[model samples]
Target: MNEAAGDGSSFSSKVIGIVFIILLLDLLGFTLILPLLPSILDHYAQAGDVTYQSLQSVVDWFRKAVGIPMEKKYNSVLFGGLIGSLFSLLQFLSSPVTGALSDRHGRRPLLILTTVGLAASYAVWAVSRSFIMFLLFRVIGGICKGNVSLCTAIVADLPCPKARNRGMAMIGVAFSLGFTVGPLMGAYFAVSSKTTGNVFYETPALLALTFSVIDIFVIWMMLPETLPKVIKGSSSHGGDSMDLLSPVSLFHFTAVTRTKEPPSKERMQKLQVLGLVYFCYLFLFSGLEFTLSFLTHQRFKFTSMQQGKMFFFVGVIMALIQGGYARRIKPGQHIRAVYMAIMMLIPAFILIGLSWNIAMLYIGLALYSFAAAIVVPCLSTLVADHGSANQKGTVMGILRSLGALARAFGPVVSSSVYWIAGAQTCFLITSASFVIPLFLLSKAQRSKEE
Candidate 1:
């Protein structure tokens, strides 16, 4: 029995190691386009493609409706925000369904399916010659991006909260490494294309496709079905009941209870509160994050290479914090760490908003990266601890879906604010908005205590 237990433990460890690599590769591909969004949009606009013009006309109408100006700088930023929001909106629609399906079928198959879909999306992107083609790429990519949520569910499947926390931290580290390296690679391609006169944006897209193919093969070969067969059979009925279109059903994880073993009221409340906190926080954070490249380009005239360097700095800081601090957080300490991280965001955004020079921006980003590194992992750990074994995938999916919803709207709203009011105002408002989630988090903690 002892030897058998040891083998199982060893296998779980191996699973986690592979999960880390998959996430790293997945995110590496996903983020390669981040630093290039502004340039890409500009290229489409200048190409005068019929689809680009059609979209531009609608944007023009919206600007007229809202009295936003026709400044070229703001135009690209707005387009970028729209593209970002579209990608996230698809994610919002798909995450819960994917999560519920994974609950029924198992994680390994879902991972493989999603990775394959992602590879197809990248292939489309590599050959995209028009704006509509690129838009289709985003659509497919977003629908398949539920891999991250599935990855988190895998962590929650581990034996204990401590193990789950460490696993979440590893996810964070993967994100850090991906973001750190991906943009740099993209920027290099961008520069090379300028000199080589290669097809614009083809190289980065091809590279992302390469990563997706590798990820698919890895999961097929190495990732065991983390969700057990018994759980899969039991949850099969509830899977079909998941209503993707109903926000209420999604947030409440209604399908999770169909198995006749609902979570306790207390646990349900905790999940609700955590989901809200995640949504609220990401709503604000993602908008600012999505716009950062545009802000730097407009304010500081940062080229693609410079934007890559900036993300590299942020990614390095985040990886260090996750590897050194976040992974070690004890079970009960998650809430406190969450509190501290959210509080840090207040100053971080303020400093970023107030930045006139690069030094001030980097200083704020240091704090931002620290907070970003810890909060999601800690919150995920807390949520994982609260979820019953059968409902882990559903719960994590609900949380990620909420985040996707926030991200879908956040960029559009923030970019509108940035376009009409300006970046300083947008940043200042977002800084103050952090209080909403913090207040909600504190209330949740108090209820948990009581």
Candidate 2:
């Protein structure tokens, strides 16, 4: 029995490591394409002088071979952005359903299925020859990928109440690390492709596909089933034996018999307040995403690579703050709130709105990113603290989906604002939106103590 316990510990560690590695690789692959997007579109649009007549001739020949219409080249970039947005939209749609499903069917199967789907999506992107094919692959990829939900469920399966906060913080760290490395690698690959005069679009796609394949293999070979089986003998004691399809009924049943802890109306109120806080948080976040890209492009005339580097900086600051400070800060301590408040007042976006140069832009961005990192992890931990173990995935999924919904409208909203008023006005509006969440968070904190 001791030997078996030891073996199980080893297996669990291995599975966790593999999951982390796969996430890193998947993120890296996505980042690689991002920096090159603008350039690739510009290339087909004939935006640059022919630095190499030979390369230009080859590009022309390839365009003709692919039967890309002359007028469609510039429009392809917009279509690509739409495809990517659609992918996120699909994720928003599927995540809660996937999380709820994992609650019933188990995390391991969903993880495997989603990983396989992600790989196939990458393959589709890698070999895509036309805008239609690209869009099709993006949609399919979005439908299949549920990494965030699956990972949240896995964390729920493993962590105890005391350790749950740390677990969530670690997940945030993993995200930051992935964001940091993925874009840097993508930029490097994009630069290399430019030198070789081959189309850069496919390189990142192929690299991402390869990583996904690796992820699939790692999961199949290294990961063990984490889901506990319901024993027939335990049914009399109120084990998980009910049909999972009826989630509402299952939740009600579980609430009734799964544990001895009585439901607290206060706890429910705290959760409601936390959920509102998260909703406001996501609203501001979506606005930032929409505003950042356009602001950088219009104000600094920054290239995609530059934009990616800015993202890399954000990732670095986020990882450091969340990994280093979030867990260490005492719960219910006023220090957390004070720190958050100070960070929020950094005037990053305000600076960005007024920046005349890249240096100032970077400084502003860094301040904003640092504040975001600190606040987001704290919010995540707060949610986890307020939720039951069985409901963690659902809560996280709901939070993420709300953020996605915000993001879905963000681009259009920002674009419209920029068109009508300008980038400065857009940023100013977004900056003010942050205040709404700050107020809500304060309310949440007060409610929690009460």
lDDT of 2 at 87: 69
What overall lDDT, based on C-alpha atoms, would model 1 receive against the true structure?
A: 0.84
Error of 2 at 261 (Å): 8.9
Candidate 1 clashing pairs?
none
Q: Put down candidate 2 lDDT per residue, 315-374, tens digits, no spaces.
A: 898788767766576777532553474346437767887788888887887777677666
Best by TM-score: 1
lDDT of 1 by residue, 80-181 (tens): 888889999899888888888888788888889999999999999999988999999999999999889999998888765455666788888998899899
Backbone clash total, candidate 1 = 0
Q: Which candidate number would show the highest lDDT if scored against the true structure?
A: 1
Global lDDT of model 2:
0.60
Candidate 1, poorest ten consecutive residues by summed lDDT: 1-10
- In candidate 2, stretches whose alpha carbon ends up further than 4 angstroms from where it belongs are 1-16, 40-85, 231-263, 333-346, 448-450
- Cα lDDT, all candidates: 0.84, 0.60
